[model samples]
Target: METTSKGTEDKGISRARFLAGAAALGLAGAVLPATGAQAADARAGRAGRPGRGLTRRGVVYTVGAGETPGTAWDPARMRADVRSIRHDLHANTVDVTGDGVERLTATAAEAAERDLHVWLQPTLGDVPQRDILEHLAECGRFADRLRGQGASVELSVGCEFWLFVPGIVPGETVLERIENLQNGTADPEQVQRRLTAFTAKAAAVGRSVFGGRLGYAAAQDDEVDWSLFDVVGIDYYSYHEHPADYVRELRRYLRWGKPLAITEFGTCTYAGAPQAGGMGWSVVDYDKDPPEIKGNLVRSERTQAAYLTDLLSVFESMGLYGAMAFEFLSADAPHRPDDPLHDLDMASYALTKPIRDRPDDPASPWHWEPKDAFHALSRRYARTC
Candidate 1:
């Protein structure tokens, strides 16, 4: 669920394919508003409070780069997207992901306008492990700026370190690491050790520059040193390996005795997608010229809606701090109902499909159509838990 726009195509496509397969805020006791200035005021009230109630009912707002240039980061598009998430999707928070400081800043400002609390993550695509701190330091600078403006933001130093950042894992590239993983050649313990060591350093630097909450987005199976963070964040995708024990799996995190948040969760728009879960998108052939499904495929928006509703129910039952759906939109995977080969949206996990052409009407500001998950989440978020 954590991705960067500027990532290499091979790396990007590997992720897109893997993702075709698979897929926070703290406030202890404050009630949240559905929207408007009141929501902003409510979040402002819990900016740094420890005992505040769950405030991160969120959806990730993303714009990717590389082959899918349609989804590349744009300030104007970000503004419109943030607004839709606030007024239309009914999310009170957003986890904004982008490559550089400027993009993250633009995203943060727009989220603030919509009264959304944020988890700001830098997309550290191919940065060497030695220099990762520099990127995170930029994030700290942005965090300081936003905090000055009274925005509720958490600085995530990095995500899925083993795959994204070099040196921590066996390979210099993500695809290499992924191959190592698939072949069972990569050692999980070794990856965890390096990640822990690097995160300790990142936490120290992040704490010095930004005075608010700080956390790292760890993969579900990777154990992190929770002492390094104020909040325990995990990018969990429910492949539903053990439905009956799902809550039990999450409960183990409470041993950290910190606020736990599901940093990412959701599936693609296709029949049996919920069953495919995190691995749904990975089913596509990345080697194909334009990336197509390996065999027969069926598109079903409802499958995605079901995935969101089911996961949200589990999150609410777990009584965890908060959760964000994997994403609000994917700009690159434009919808093409006219041509099956060009209909790349079947591989996308976004809540809405990007429109190939904008309508001539000024009234029609949106460039995408809401899928079933959008309505499902909007209705769910409209209610108070």
Candidate 2:
């Protein structure tokens, strides 16, 4: 992996210069009008909506690692790490999983020492409806843990359930399962009713816990039940064909009067190779395979960097609230040696090569190294903050 110094100053581009540059790049007509001055101001840290800011105050935490410190809760070490990350990255928000509440609370206290925000990406197992009430009840019980630690928490009940449901189950079976899970029966009509009921219940539960502010992460556009969330969260791996498209999508969501966050956004370096561990949901591979292929899609470091730059640019222009890269490190295990075709096959592709050490090692090919994209994003965040 190649390391590059992050430039401290903005590569000053005036409106006219920006237009000229866009025209030269054949994007002037396509992006200028839709992304007007308001958006531009948002990016520039000038005029912003109530909670919108260009500061890159975001970090994505893994289930048992990354932000969590030590085998157990070593308060001193956790505080040091949290302070280091916040000071170094200018991060204001750190995402924590539900099961990791104890560690999350510990980290939140550390964050409080540094004055940062915390968002909880609560993990509900495959069967959310099985104990939806119980799941929510636990969240209520945990709310005090968050408040006690001097951290405000946004409860993310489910992540990417859309992929697990309709993406995997047949339509008829999908309806049946939804019905069974929601209402204790397998009737299609009941399925729709249950979904509606669940949305209301979830929203009510969230409002009671977070004072009417709730967040949810969705992997696909279709998975979003907008009525259930105050803020819409999305995880995009390959949706960004270009930077302009990213801007357009953000604008679409911004119109809803709700803030938008790119909860998880990163490119897989492997292209089309099967994800090493079959751990994530992906649409393509990086090895120049046809879109229909089921594997990791490999893109060069330069391409990845450019994509990230464009993404950040769009986020700035659209007045987006914030974004978190998919991860800070690589997976702990190699592609599951026993099942190469599993969902996580593309897991290793998310990290930069240097972090991984040996990108070619299949057994433990997954490692965390900062690639050009990481630096680019870090620099961008540093500047904006």
Candidate 3:
């Protein structure tokens, strides 16, 4: 999710202007009215035509992740989140990503209870080949367990292996790998060869134990051999310079003859965040003890909503398998009510505002409020084609 000198930065679209455009397009008012019958009618309209308009409407529910504080493991909260996705967002799938096996299995099981397909992605960050295989086997074990429970699950072998895992590329840190690639120090041919070899091995090991769909979150620019898996997955993010090519670039996946999954895509909660994919994570200065905005940035929830709606349209129009929003929430980047201007949560790609102080019993479910994107996504996903 981090990049070097790709020259792709936020284009700084005016929030007010984008919202004005959305209002004119009727997207702002497209949210389903708060009534169960109306929602059911809207959903029934699409029942006849399946696999249209992101049939696998999905969001990545990240837990126990590295950069963001792990969502506290609560089965009740997990059930609520899954139900919310199925009922409110009209999503049929959940990309349950995390590191630990226990949390990953529990999340997948809960999503299964809600009848949502699960993309089980476990992060084994910056480890060697042996460790990677070990993690893959662990995922396979959990996938089998979930299957025994009759849960639908797909095992993502790993994410961005060339960048994060060792032996595949020559860099001590993720940033270092990016620097090497930019400086012509990392051989492209050698890197691709190592990646292909390692990925093939991962798929082989994963398939041995995991009896379900398999794929890797290949970086958009990476030349991955897709024959090893059932799904062609890409962590696609729009760039400022290549706005028009977004759909055109994704069409190449059709050549793989596998289900195309946009494994990750989403915008931050700012005016220009739609185009902030490549460099969004790097924009903030994290050197300080507590990260804050690097400069004055305008908060525009509509920009994110617009970006998501447009991308969903492209995915649906193309008749691709499915896509997952980068994330449902960023628990660590909680809202800053006191310093609203410095609320880094606004920069989060998540569709909800993470609240830190839970004003109730310690056992109360975690509280999070939705953004405009959440409602917009619900409306868009509810449509048929």
Best by lDDT: 1
Residue-by-residue lDDT tens digits, candidate 1, 1-385: 3343323442455346434332211111111112354334333431122334345788876644534444456678778889988888888889887566677778887898778888887656666765667878887888878988898888888777766777776776665666566556767667667867877888888888889998877766565677989988887765574543566557666665788888878888888776655555555665676556655678888888987887777777666788888778776566777666656778777889876664222222337889999999999887753
Stretches of candidate 1 above 4 Å error?
1-14, 17-54, 66-69, 184-188, 241-244, 358-366
Model 2 misses residue 112 by how many Å?
A: 3.9
**By the TM-score metric, which is better: model 2 or model 3?**
3
Write model 2 residue lDDT over 199-309, tens digit each, in one string.
556666666666535776654333235767878776654444565555544554554467777776654444432222122222323233211225334434555566556
lDDT of 2: 0.46
Put down candidate 3 lDDT per residue, 123-163, tens digits, no spaces.
Answer: 65554578668877987888878877788788888776776
Model 3: runs farther than 4 Å from truth? 1-51, 65-76, 240-244, 358-366
Sort order, lDDT high to low: 1, 3, 2
Q: Which predicted model would earn the best TM-score?
A: 1
| TM-score leaderboard ranking | 1, 3, 2
RMSD of each: 9.9, 13.3, 11.9
TM-score, each model?
A: 0.83, 0.60, 0.80
Question: CA lDDT of 338 in candidate 1?
Answer: 69
